[model samples]
Target: MKKWFLISTIVLLMIINTNPASAISNAPIHWGFTKGKNEQQAEAGKAYDELLRKHHAFYKGDPNKKVLYLTFDNGYENGYTPKVLDVLKKEKVPAIFFVTGHYLTSEPKLVQRMVNEGHLIGNHSWSHPDLTQVSNEKLKEELKKVKDETARITKQKEMHYLRPPRGILSERTMQLANEEGYTHVLWSLAFKDWLVDQQKGWKYSYDNIMAQVHPGAVLLLHTVSKDNADALEKVIKDLKARGYTFKRIDKFK
Candidate 1:
């Protein structure tokens, strides 16, 4: 009887070790973007769009309106977010900030300020790993860690949106995130704003952003870019001059 019990325990351990949910897949397609003259410019293709819709993900919104949803990916604070916040406040524009574990732990005050100022704080995963390469267990943990911590710091119970780290995602990853009650939020417009030294000046940033302005554009700007911070006011002004309006991601529909 004891021998049989030992065998059963071994089999149980093996089952746990080989759980199918712990498996990872090599996702074939990395997210891509194509610059175009209108809403078609940032299309992620029909297949991709259907897949995202199956999992309730979004990169842009309301293709018929000239509205822009602004978001920032905050992997870490570089002392420039305050300026960004200032610009948003002065302009009365709303945005979402996708943050990591380090950003939450290191800049609790800034995180709090973001919450206080009526900006949405989203989960960017704990360590910013490529979720497409991780097992469902690890993927959930990565998202949950940041969500729990952000809630702890900001006193908010729900973090409803996620931007997959490095913009890497798979269909399975999106399904798992959806099961965890998150809407995957990707972007329609992004540039080299994350690299501090590679900044091409505020004018260059302004021109590039304006050139791509479209109906329902979800613009992803890195808060760490001083060029972005400096150019935000003018960017908003120009966008408004062109009849564009800023909106929060929750209001995308």
Candidate 2:
């Protein structure tokens, strides 16, 4: 009986040791953080900072440089992206747009325009599902579909960044994304500008950004917000006057 019990324990240990899934946590994390104020850097807390660091994810760049990275989450178009693009073009600033599969299929022209305008198209998953619930195979399928379709439409050879759907992530998800050659790009500055119905005015968007602006900030904006569209050019001008240089995601260091 003792021999049998020892054998069972050894089998259990072997199973635990061999299974990588058993060692990694898939707990869903709805990304949130302490917002920066007065040019102070935002903090994602010690635990989250360590988690991102472990998987080579980035929320902001070097804190000493007066640099800004503009990123947009394009889950679905609401007709304001063209205005946002116009502002970027006029200001000579670079930005990245994390797009969904729906966006890819429905707005291929805009996707091509994004590539043509020298902006990046990042993966926001094929269906915008909570990635923590997906299997390894499903996750790979999701990422590949976006990359493949974006390449097909835009003729852009490589895609390299991902923003987990609904601002959700986990260690397992980040690891899976990194394994598939994509880095997680979270933001250091954002606000409630995504609610199309609740927009106060262009000033509302501009104020939130200026209040949170800091060295090495990654600003996440939604192209669907009309206020953001109206406020973008002024925001760019003001930020430039403040000595902040806009940069692309690939240039982060």
Candidate 3:
């Protein structure tokens, strides 16, 4: 009887030791930007693509296609989204707007316009906290509140895409979010469009965007930038000239 009890305890310990849940690491991820069209950049992009593929997350579109997926991060209303929406409407381009709690509560009208205009609205968390630092319960609450509220207001039930705040994500957080039925969306190309005070003029915006235009690019533009608003129309036209087509994120993969 004593031997049987000891053997049972040893087996239980082995099972606990090998449990997958116990192996989850909560380390933070430092996202690095892939810069310039060099071999190094290409390799980095490929590695990133593999990482996303492993976790079923997305940072860019299909590399074999001449398609661009456009997304905007809307943390707050800076009085530039309406103009951005107008340009999108005029261009007949579809985009995804990742909105935080503040944007949803303060700019319901704009949110409604986005849905009505056939643009996709994604969850950008409730308070824009670094999800990696939050507890799993808080993470679920953050995502759920925004999703519930957005659905309540927009009458749209599908809001499965999640863009981590400030573009920071960890392996554990990504897995947690995926378990909640969200596909994490990052960006292949993003500039300093979010810094309002560091505006480099519309020309700088135009050149920066145009120079990096590539196939299967997931382009992130902050809706709060005046320079982005000013250069949006011309950028779209230029992209068309280069034979690139705009695709919605849902259809990107």
Candidate 4:
């Protein structure tokens, strides 16, 4: 009986020890704080520069008229994502999730749930690295990594939107992403919402988010915020009441 108990314990330990770190491959992006400057890199990538101009022209400087797009960046899953999803589900609003490679691999079910529920999934790079700092080759690889992983796991066509890590953009990063079939995305408003170490309560963040909302606002939220989860549904309801309808990014020129 003692031997059987030890064997069972060992088996359980083994199961826990060998689980995948990401739903995908093991890479350095999995183990580092994604830090960097991207606007400088765009100057270097002529193609990236063109992409910026293209999208700017596409919108014709009128993105804030009777439409709103809500995008969440998924660098790491929060304990709150499930609840956030619950709120979104309850409200019947479809939003976009710009996911990193780790999010694709660590939360495969969430990826599937995003697609199954008709929300768009855009690429946020493989490891959330600042694209402008890496070489063009590396940037392309990063772009492909997230796009491929998310599509492969979810069995969906790769979406065309790509949000830069830390909102950093470069000519090179933009060019590479565009060449690879993505339009660079940046938010009009984002605060210190990504730091999982700090616990700013929802009431504070909610007021901040509400204060920032405008016509055709593309609000940025992170998956790792308790305040975000708490504020999400309430914000959605409050925004809807105030005549803001949520939609995926509808213009990509």
Candidate 5:
């Protein structure tokens, strides 16, 4: 009876091990991603393609309307993401974070915190580069590198949006993003906050951002700089006063 029990256990282990669904995918995402010739092409680059994709909505209408979409690009891992999260929490607002693998692998807890706080995290590619010029294979690597790492960290299934590095886009880039199951999020509202200039204080940013505020505004800021994190609270208040409700840009909003 003991021998029979041991044999049953061994068989069960084998069955589970051989199942594709049961196995963890540890393979490198870069193994298949390649670079494209979009930049060199006389016409347009190849279309973007990926193994999976995720995005719920795009720009609904005119940019000058009442809605504003707040987004931040995460290139480097700044200790400030938590502070940014704190500000967002206090204001009860939702913003999109365009994140890179550097940020994901280095600051995983912050990513979890972002998810917990009900904010959208977008695939900002593995490395920050112009996606419009990369091949579909490379495009896959650019996105999955983060998605896979994020999955491992969050223990969650998947992410929804992907905005390529530098906000660069091409036919191939769009196709690749689509294939990867992501919506190519573009910003109708962005200013010098992307700049690293420290002189561009909260007042400068506030005025510039406020001037450009319209419906469905996908405002881009960086988490690495003291400027953005510092500007968060005041910006939220100013927008509130202007009668704009901070929200996720989607079908419902």
Candidate 6:
């Protein structure tokens, strides 16, 4: 009986190991990249490129195209989104806003305005938890809540893009997200601009952006930063002058 029990236990372990989900690493990866300069594209290195590509994710667009994709994280409103929206309206720039459940509930009108004004809304998870640490069911729940709430509020039936909460992800999370029809939208350009209390100035935001500007760059900005709102208009005008056309995420190649 003891010998048979040992054999059964070994077979169970083998079965668990062979499971597809179990085979992928759940080790969390905090997304980072080497900054691009002189108008060259930023490098996410080979491993990140491979992992992202395999999951149909996007960090940047075609390297040869002087096209930019602008995205904002809306975890919570800080009374500056209106200014940002106004700038986008004036300059006719397109952007995607990744919103959390809190944002959806707390600022439904703003979210509706986003859709009404031809901007795309993306899922930033329900509670903004580190997705790599959540179980498959929990992850699904988190995503579902945001998607459903977004649909209810904006009447936008499809939510295809997802920016992992806190920029944390893993192979397991990516695979799960892909299975849910969410294409992970990572960024190729970002800075320490999310800190609300540490905002330097509008020029600070502008300078960092100008320095990192590149072909096919995807920029991640926080709506909570007053600097971003203040500098947005000039940034758009200047980037346009530099011959960079801002494109919607859906139009990205």
Q: Quote model 3's TM-score.
A: 0.91
Q: Write the per-residue lDDT of candidate 5 for residues 124-150, one digit (tens) a residue.
A: 888887765565577788788888888
Scored by Cα lDDT, where does model 1 land? 0.86
My TM-score estimates for the predictions, one after another, are: 0.88, 0.94, 0.91, 0.74, 0.72, 0.94
Could you tell me which residue pairs clash in candidate 2?
none
- In order, the Cα lDDT scores of the candidates are 0.86, 0.94, 0.85, 0.69, 0.65, 0.95
TM-score of 1: 0.88
Superposed by TM-score, candidate 6 places the C-alpha of residue 163 at a distance from the truth, in angstroms, of 0.2
TM-score of 4: 0.74
Per-residue lDDT tens digits for candidate 2, residues 99-179, read 999999999999999999999999999999999998999999999999999999996879899999988998899988988
Cα lDDT, model 1, residue 3? 100
Per residue, candidate 3 scores C-alpha lDDT tens digits across 1-253 of 9999999999989988876545676677656556434211212466656767777987766667778889999999889999999999999999999999999999999999999999999999999999988988899999999999889889678788999998888878888888999999887777788998888778878887777767788888998898999999999988888788998999977
For model 6, the stretches where C-alpha displacement exceeds 4 angstroms are: 1-18
Descending-TM-score candidate ranking: 2, 6, 3, 1, 4, 5
**Count of backbone collisions within predicted model 2:** 0
Deviating ranges (above 4 Å) for candidate 1: 1-28, 38-41
Residue range 89-199, candidate 4, lDDT tens digits: 899877788888888888999889988887888888888777666766788888788777777877676678887787766554555566777876665545678877786
- Residue 202, candidate 5: Cα error in Å is 1.5
**Local error of candidate 4 at residue 211 (angstroms):** 0.8
For each of the candidates, the C-alpha root-mean-square deviation to the true structure, in angstroms, is: 4.7, 1.7, 2.7, 16.6, 12.5, 2.4
lDDT by residue (45-85, candidate 1, tens digit) is 89888877888888878777989999999998888899999
> Using lDDT as the measure, which candidate wins?
6
